[model samples]
Structure formats: structure tokens, C-alpha cells
Target: MYIIQKLINRFFVKNKLGIFSFTFFIVIFSSVVMQILEPKTFPRWFDALWYVMTTVTTVGYGDFYPVTVAGRMYAIFIFLVGIGIAGLAIGKLVEAMGAHRKRKEEGRLTFKGKNHFVIIGWSEKAKYAINEITETHPNLEVVLIDRLPVTPITHQNVHYIQGDPSIESTLIQANIEEAQSVLVFSDDSIHDSALADGKTLLIVTSVERLTPHIHSTVEIKREEHIKNFRHAKVDEFVLSHETVSRMAVRSAFSKGITGIYTQLLSHKEGENLFEVQKKAEWRTYKDAFDGLLEQGATLIADGNDLSINKKLNEAIPEDARLYIICSKDVYEALA
Candidate 1:
């Protein structure tokens, strides 16, 4: 026991690889020495290895035992030192696994997933967005970037990166160049609308500089601040304040309007907006509208153009993007 403690204190200070390498050397040496001492007991190298492993682990299945005096002496030597080496190797392996998990939870590891959604900032709104995205597409991955020391949320499909979103290195760590899209949310902690929008603009500028082809959606507190974001070439702007104000006004004037908006925006148990591929047979807007209507789906728009009813005779362009509103099962049936 005393010798075992001393061996641990002296050599266990080495890193994981060192300890494991030494353990492997000791195991090989024991197998070789055992075979040389007692060829009758361990005729093959594999037999010697099995005997050495069983003895060191204390399993001691006595199928093979040394008959000669010299072989027993070497076996005693193995019993004393080999057990401690085996324990040290196992301890180091467990320690390495635990350290790796800690680094991942601290958001100190780089994300390697491609074609994923990268959401910047941590807030209630960001949490809701994460939930909505996961519910809509369970297979897609989402990476969240923020300055918090530790990750705020934990999910199988979501990865967290702790850093300033405006830094190029931080964006690189999140694999922004290969990401499908990026959503930059104004910091909820900043009370000033101009300052919040300014922070969002900085993040968007950094993202666009690193990934010119990536689609970027940004949220701004004030509607007038969108003009400043235009130079950054942001793909979409979400006006937070104006949208809420309009929703509140509509709800006040009309009954049950909020529920309609929620159904259209969410993946919940109601009708929702979905995009479908343009068919080759639909030569005109009228054909698409009539075909989708017969299939129990309302053709709402072609891309952002909602005047399809007035332009029913208009030719459907080659790049036309179609959108529809339908129940979940109805959409699935049509799909």
C-alpha cells in the first residue's frame, strides 16, 4: 500500500497521454517477461496478454498460472506495480472526459456544424425564437452567440458560443461562413432604442464582412434606424417597436386579431404560413391559385407580392417563390 501511494504521488503528476503510454509499456513488458519465464503456462503472446490484463485488473481468472519459481516471482512483481499503473490510466481517462465536458459547457469550444442558424444575443425573445425554430425543424441545428460566461440554455440541437458577436474571431468560431442564416437581436438590457439598434448594426456589419453570402435578419428597436442598416447589405429588417405597436392597434380595433397573428406566425395548433415550390404546370398565377385552392390551401402570395388575385393572368416567372396558408396536416398532405 505504501509503495502504491508513493508511485501515484510521483508519476501521476504527468498528463493523461503520458500516464496511458507508460501503462501500455508496462502491460507489454509484463506480457513479454511472463511468456519468457513460463513458456508452458503462456505459450502464445495473446495468452500472456490476457493473463497480465486479468492479474492487473484483479479479476484473477486462474485459468493460467505460473508453475516455475522464476515465473511466480515475476508475477509477484506484476501484482505490485501493474495494479497501480492500471488505476492511474483509468483515472486520467475519466479526468480527460470530464474536462472536455466542462470546456463545452463553458462555450470555449468551436462549433463545426454547417448550414445552421446562428442567433446572436440572449434574451426572452431569443429563447422564444429558439423554441419556434426547433419546433418547426427538429433536425436543423442552432448556434447561439453571446457574451455570457456560461451557456444559458441546453439542448441537443443547439450550440452556445460565448463571445462578442462583433468580433470576427468569435464569428469564425461559430462557423458563420457556412451558416444558413444569422439573426441579430438588439440587446434587451439596453433601454435606449438608438443604442440598442446601434449595437445590432455593429453585429450585422461584422457578420456581413465575414460572410458576404450569408442571409442576415436584424431586429431594431426603432423604425427610423433601418436606413442606417441598409449600407450593411442586411437581407431583412424586423421592426420590433412598429410591429408591436401595429399589433396592439389592430387588436384594440378588431376582436380576436391577436390570435390570428399568432396562428400565422407560430407552429402551433392552427393555420400557419408555409412556402411551397413553384410547379412547372402552373404557367400563370391563376393556375397556381386555383390548384392550391382545390388542394385546401390558400395561395397567399408569390414571394412578397400579395396582389395575385388582381394579376391572375400574369405569367409565373421562372424564379417565382410561392407561399400558402394551411393547417399542419393539410400542408403535410399536399406535400
Candidate 2:
């Protein structure tokens, strides 16, 4: 048994397509040999082929059998070789599938998609962002690039590539050029805020260098690293410490503000921020605001500038996009 296993392994290693091709050849050869030896039993080529298949698979029905001595001797040879070849073919196919799965889990597989979200880094914040996006936009495709050995988040729409996010090759594997936006996260495992921010800046710079057109949001642990990211032309920056500190202070001063913010950010409950393109007939901010209100939405901003109550009289640009606070159902209803 050991000798046979070793020989099969050696044969597969020497010839990349050996197992499958050899199995196919054995099936054909056995069929032909059976037709020649059992001419009386199976006069037709199709009947001989059927007999070979059933016998090799160990599903022999009593109807088909080798009546002559020469045919019986050939049948013994066919059973040993044919069954071994079929087993080897099945084992090889299973091994290939397992290898492919391992490569995917290890982030070695290439991603192919457009308008997908590319998340650079693996941390608690990154994991939360992935889950939130997948849950909120179930159809949106997300590719995660990190230096971890395996993917931390498991979702059907999420593809993971395990490598340094700062590396251009890794971003290419994630298909950065086809991505609509990227989110660069700081390494939370790194205790030094400066070092973590430095790593994040490298990833942001790499992303910008590869695809300058794609929008990117970067997370900065220290305020000092903001300038570095700005130089990289990052679309937006999230200061974790600053935001948390302010939220904590605000929560202390006014109770329920934090809970309100959480509810607004969550996709499952309350209304969240959404952006919609301005219509041609909407001449002013007030017109767009009223239109959205009719659809159960409240216009909060015009592009990056907050509209709220100040820009009511301002002329809405034809190409302007309006940010509104609304639920997913409400936003889709307007669509």
C-alpha cells in the first residue's frame, strides 16, 4: 500500500496533468480491451464501455460478467488498475480544491470587481467597518488588505488579501484602480501612536500613488500625523482620539447625545447620513431640502459644506450632491 501511494505521488509530481489524463486513458483503454476480449458477451462498443464503467466503479450488476477464461483474467487486471486510477483522480481533485481554498483564506487570491470598497488594515475598527458595510449594503463588494496571515472577517461579499497594505502589489491584488473608495486604518496593535500613524500614511500614499482618482478615508491615531496624510491627498481623515474625547465630553454635559449619535450611525435603527444627487429642477438649496423632506429625508449638507439652515437661499449647482439624514428605506423609496 505504501509503495503504491509513493508511486502515485511521484507520478502526479512528475506530470502535472498525469492523474486526470491517466484516468481518462485507463477508462478508454479498458473499454476497448473488454470489447475485444468479451466479443461474445458484449458485441457493441457502447455495451463494453458501460460494463467497464460499472465494473471499475464496483457497481457490477450480475447481468454483465466475463464468461470466458481470457475475459475473466482481463477483468481482474481492469479492476485493480481502474479502481486505483479513479481513486487517484478523486484524491487529486480534492487536493486542488483544498489548496485553492487555503490560498483564498490566506489572501493570496486576486480580486476582480468595480466600485468595490478596499479596506487597508486588520483591526477591531476595520472588522467593525467591514461588518457594518456588509450588513448595511449587502450587495456592496469589500476587499480587505492586511499583513495578517489569514482574513479576520468572513463575509461572502468580502475578499481578503494578506499582505502589507503599504505594498503596491497588495493594493493591485485588491484591485484599487477599480475601487470606488478605500479606508486606511491605523494598526491598533502598535502601542506607539506615531508609528501606527506612520504605517497608515505609507498605505495611504501607496493607494494614492496607484490610483489618484479613488476616494480614500484614513484613520489617524495622533493629531500630529494629519499633515502627513494631507500631503498624500487623502479625501477624509478620522481622528480617533479627538473624536472620542469630544464625544465623551459631550456625553457628560448632555446625556443621550452619544446614544443618539450611535443610533444615527447604525444601519439597523434610526436615520443615517446619505447622499443624493441634485435634480435639474431644484434651483435652490431650500427647494432640494423641501423635496427630500417630502421623501422622509432631511437635507443636511451640500457637497462637503453643511447646508442645514444657512444655505437655504443659495442656488443649488446642477452637479451638486446633497447629503441627507434618512433611513435606507426612505432613501430607496425616493429612488
Candidate 3:
């Protein structure tokens, strides 16, 4: 009952289109019912409906006419009510169509797909992430949600929807439920990192509320908030500042460290981390590493099970299930 009342309020009170539609339906119904009751005195019900339409439109096709006094009175009343209703209906229809077109033009439309990536926020990190994601998953579609306007990317795989990512409406627009994963990035302003973090947390909370099982990664600038974010159950957190500081320290200590790191980060020529399924036919770390080297890709580390067999290197286990660092060409060939 409450829902019905809410709907009535929305249709009759909130939107003029709904009111106009209701009026149009009433006019049509009354004209049909009246004609049916006095069909002998008047023409056919369809003929009467047509007469009402033409009368409202001022077309006045003389083919159908009313002979009885009662029919004429009814026709006069219909002409008056139908003309107003028809005019309002046409106006409302035009308005609704215009709004829909505007939303589409502004890239505020919803999309749904499985295995798609949902990107929340439009910072520089997001740009970098998109570049990396496209190289890795060329066929994967990316859905971006932000408050600002949606800009077109050179890559056809990226899609944009404009809205506050913290809002459920925006997440729905990006099809959060069907997405394989979501990457929430920081806002553009450099000084507003905490503010961005708060916004991101809200978005994370909202996503969890709607879909508790969704996989999500968030960017955190400060180490202090890591615990709080972890408590929120975020799947992954990328410490951008920490990574940059590590690179800076490495560069300071070694002459070619920056260049080597750049190559490692890139997918083209240097070592890039890739996750691949281990077949039952192939077992043991030594065998897998040797096979990957033969395939023109060097094995770095494993991703699945991080625990290492301590004999070779305490940091890296020989029996670990995940491996990192490989060339794109080699990874694709193996895949």
C-alpha cells in the first residue's frame, strides 16, 4: 500500500509526464465507454474514438457525424477534454525524450556485462591503471564512474558514466554486480588525498551494502588509514606513495635502478607479473620455471599461494603457486 501510494505520488505529483499520461488514459477511456453505451444512437465505438481524436486535433473529418442530441453533447465534452489532454500528452512525451537524449549524450547511461572492470574515480592513477588493464585484458570492457564529464579514451574498451561513485545509482549504472572486479582510484586534487579516501570508503561501503561478495581494490595514500580500510573488507589496497618512495630510494642507490624498474613495470620488453593456471600435468616450481624460460618468459614469483619453500629464498618459496614478471608476448603464447 505504501509502495502504491509512493508510485501514485511519483506519477501524478512528481512528474508532469505521468499526470499527462493519466489524463490521456482517462479521456480515452471515457470516450470509448460512452460510445459503447450509445452505439445505436452514435456511430461505432472506434468511430467515436476517432471522432474525439480528430476533434481534439481540429481535423474534423466529416465522414462520421453525431445525430442524437445526447451524442452531440457527449462529443462536445470529449472535444474539450481530449484537446487539453492530447496537447499535454504530446508536450510531456517530447520532454521525456529530450531528457533521455541528454543523458545519453552526457554519458550517464547504465551498462551491464560479466567479467567487466568497474573503475571508480578519474585520477591520473586511473589513467595508468586503464593503460595497464587494456594491455593485459584487451577484450575486457572498463566502466568509469565519476562526478565530472566523461572523456573519450583512445582505446575502445573503456566506457564512461558520469555520477558520484559513492551513490548506488552510479554503481548500478556501471553494473557493479556483474563486474569481475572494481578499482577505486583517488580524486585529482593533490592536497585532498584524505578527502578522496573518505569518498572512496563511502563508495566501498555502498558497494558492499549492495553486493557483499564483490571484489574491490582501493587506493590509499596514508599508511595510517590502512587498518580502517582493511576493516572495511577491501580486497586490495595500492599504496601509491609507498611504491613511488621505494622507486626513489632504489634510484638513489643504483644508477640504472629507475630504468630497470620502468622496464619491469611495462608489459612490452621487460619483466611483468602474470597469473596463469598450473596444469596437473606440470608440477614442481623447478619444472614450471624451466618450462616458462623455454617459452621465452622468465618466472619471477607466484601469486596464488604466497607461502614459499624456505630452502631457496626465505622471501620467495619454491613451492608457491603464483609467479610474477613476464613479457606480454610470452604470457599470451603460454595462455
Largest TM-score belongs to which candidate? 1
> lDDT value for candidate 3?
0.74
Which tens-of-lDDT digit does each residue in 206-268 have in candidate 1?
999999999999999998888889899998999988999999999999989999999998888
Query: How well does candidate 1 match the true structure in TM-score terms?
Result: 0.90
Q: Please name the candidate that would achieve the greatest lDDT relative to the true structure.
A: 1
For each candidate, what TM-score against the reference?
0.90, 0.86, 0.63
lDDT order of candidates, top first = 1, 2, 3
Q: Candidate 2 residues 9-91, lDDT tens each?
A: 78864454887898888888888988898898988988888888887777888677889898899888988888877777777
**C-alpha RMSD values across all candidates:** 3.1, 3.3, 8.6
Off by over 4 Å in 2: 1-10, 29-51, 59-75
TM-score of 2: 0.86
User: Candidate 3, which segments miss by more than 4 Å at Cα?
Assistant: 1-102, 150-155, 190-192, 304-321
Lowest summed lDDT window (length 10), candidate 3: 308-317
* Deviation of model 3 at 209, angstroms: 2.9
Name the lDDT value of residue 274 in candidate 1. Answer: 93
Better of 2 and 3 by lDDT: 2
Q: Candidate 1 vs candidate 2: which has greater TM-score?
A: 1
Q: Model 3: per-residue lDDT, tens digit, 47-83?
A: 7677666777678887666677776777777777767
